[model samples]
Target: MPLVALVVAALAIGFEQLIQWKYGPMGIIAFIALTIGLKAKNTAISGLGAIILVMLLAQSN
Candidate 1:
């Protein structure tokens, strides 16, 4: 679980960089791949939840 979380975190950071580079769709693709590859429901859910939170926070700001 911890390893999965760490990998997800790394991927998330990479996705964020991809988004910053204007490859937003690729970021989503990467996210989906990460989620599916991990094969952990909690990891996938937390990853999506974090993405949502970041999007919401960015929109609000």
Candidate 2:
């Protein structure tokens, strides 16, 4: 249903905003890259984004 899809999208946007607030712009960039890469079916882009996310996680602790 369109309403369900809209709600999911709104939730996703809010979640992304939370991530950005907590982790900063790089987090947003990394997530965007990961999402886009997966959608586009590009392994290299996805791998790079995964690597960045891993690094960010490591740095957090």
The number of the candidate with the highest lDDT is 2
- Encode model 1's per-residue lDDT on 1-61: one tens digit a residue: 9999999999978867765465355455555555564676567665764575466447657
lDDT of each candidate versus the true structure: 0.63, 0.89
Residue 7 of model 2: what lDDT? 100
Score candidate 1 by TM-score against the native.
Answer: 0.36
In model 2, the worst 10-residue window by lDDT is 15-24
- Candidate 1 — which residues are off by over 4 angstroms? 23-61
Model 2 lDDT, full chain set: 0.89
User: Which digits, one per residue and each the tens of the lDDT, describe model 2 over residues 1-61?
Assistant: 9999999999989989987997799988988888889999999888888888888889999
